[model samples]
Target: MRVDLHPFAGIGWPGRERCGPMRRCLPQLRDSRVGIFGVGSALAPHVSRQLDLLPALVPALEHGSPRERLARRIFDNACIDERRFCIPDFRHGTRKVLYDTLHPGLGRRMAVYRREAPRLAASACEPALKSARVAADEITHLVVVTCTGIFTPGPDVELAERLSLQSDVERTIVGFMGCSGAFHGMRVARRAALERNARVLLVCVELCSLHQRDEAGAGALVAQSIFADGATAVVLGAIRDHDRTLALLGEDRTCLEPGTRAALTWEMRDDGFAVRLSPELPSLVEGRVARFVTPLLDGIDPQVRPAWIVHPGGAAILRAVQRGLGLERDDLASAWSVLRRLGNTSSSAVLYVLEEALARLAVGAEGVMLGFGPGLTFEALRFQRGPGV
Candidate 1:
């Protein structure tokens, strides 16, 4: 199912009347009312390692082996210089090796997640609340997004306790959506803020490092070379007078490209969650992104050139989107910066780019964020800087 939400203009759902011209929609809010008030991010505590050390760090890529050679090539071309991990063994030698046999049981991995995810998530959320100038008791809703790990009495419950949020704060979790998960969480947060006039706290945290496997195959190698661990949080609410927030301008209909379900897949296995990335995925994005983005662009004023916040799934995916949309390299600088420094943090990756873009966006500037996930699904959120800074 696809959803096109432009609250200030009007919403477009299947079987509903399509949104009219901007002139007809402009008076609904006088100006955008709902928006992102603040953003904060945190990385796993372990120090990062350069790409060159990965073979030595991961046992699956033993020196002088075929996998090691393949990994080196992929890492060199990945455009990533360093990546962090929650597991200290990735950067420092430890007798208790996590991926000793390339097959750590799912139970073992999840145990690590249950212990660490909440701490990292809380670290991110605290600063987000501080930056938004909203106290813990003021949050009316909580939304958490993740694809890396799961447990009952999950991170959502722990986050509230760690942050001292009220016991009655509404909570929701968006899981297993892969890289596009943040957009899905934002969609939910937008609804809560608009429908209930709520102050929503959205947290996206991924422990991708825990899923690294020593399995053989180009797909596994590529995934290993580019995935990392990180968390990001954003506070959403009604834009106040003279606020310098990123207003929710609109959201385009989400599209699932046909016949591409296998292009990207994240599955849970006896060992742990595994990611399979088809080499053809980049080309698929290049072929479809323009058509996917056209309708959303048509809804906006033609004179405005919106900034592009495409997810940096990898260098290839970023280039594909840039080529498809006729965008310049500078258009995606924020994405590339994140990819180079942190690798792909899966669900939290796009928000890192959004945090960077927030610092550079001029008052009244507009931008679009795009994310892709397991279903070969593409999601888009349109936003603009509110009037006063």
Candidate 2:
């Protein structure tokens, strides 16, 4: 709350003499991998009505067999039907039926980076970096995170070299952490800072839509429609004084419905990626969310501010989040804006929500960044603003 809560917390810090408290907090943050921002990419097959999922889910529908009956039952009662998703189909003809969406080849990946990385760097990370920039030879550690491709030479190395980061600067790559990977990366960065007193840079890039599947059933379509791609890069540094606009606030997390793993699944295949989404998902969230999340929000004030920065999995998913969290329509405006502008960007979506929350919501207010994936589980982090957080 000192970093986030106390600001609007109705409890102001008593003095500029924060040395004792900051010392206690600084060491804890040293290697905590505790915080960050989000980046995202667009969905592949580009979410069009021209493509169809009804045919894919009920392949033998035209044959009129018992399988069709089973398919009907599955579709009628499943999340797909209830969610009103049109399988968010694709437009590729050659790639259609062969796979969901095209995985980026090296050339294609470079093409995306060409247009995206520069603009993103200029717009997001660069501003933060510029805010925190210092004389040369100061930055000591860098952490790059992503989960959407294959490459031995990897984007991290390419990014560092391109940016002219110090040649000997310590660099690390975090891969395959999934939607919650950035948090996982923060864990790693926190450790690095704690051990070496290293200044760290966390970069997130996920072209989520690149992993979309084409001829899959409703599950794949739904997941792909809601998941887009983008990148986020931020610098977390240590400062003796509180003059810096940004500061780390306390953070807490939890998992839910551990047994519900079958609710959502993501796996790679020769045809791209296959996902199985169950209709029981929203209900799972509705039932368990309050129990799981409320505890996480236990000490926070809900009356003055109960804002939420939920990863917008999709339009329906947002609806589920609102109902589950017991929030009114206006509580998650930032989340909706990101979802409307950029689909779910996996791990980065939460970061995008955080960015939105920081920019749009009142400072020092409490908010939750929540997401759910294959675990059929929920992951949430409670946060208040950092200094200028």
Q: Highest lDDT: give the candidate number.
A: 1
| lDDT per residue as tens, model 2, 1-389 | 33232222222232222211211222233333333322222222234321233453324344456654444544433222111111232332534422233343444544554444434433345544654554224557778777665565666566666566788878777766577666666656756665444567777766654444444355544564455556665666544443343435345454635578777776766544555768787777766665555444445544566567776666667777777655665777887777666666766677667666776656556666677756765666555555553
Worst 10 residues of 1 by lDDT: 15-24
Query: Residue 148, candidate 2: how far off, in angstroms?
Result: 1.2
Q: Tell me each candidate's RMSD, in Å, in order.
A: 5.2, 9.0
Which candidate has the top score in TM-score?
Answer: 1
Across 1-389, the per-residue lDDT of candidate 1 in tens digits comes to 45453322122333222222222232222365678887899988775656655654456556788778877787789899888777776765564457665567989999999998999999999888887878999999999999999998988999999998999999999999999999899888888887565899999999998886667577777787788899999999876566666555564457777789999999998878878999999998887776565555544555566877878899999998877777778889999999999999999999999888888888767778888998899887777765422
Candidate 2 TM-score, C-alpha based: 0.69
State residue 166's C-alpha deviation in candidate 1, in Å: 0.5
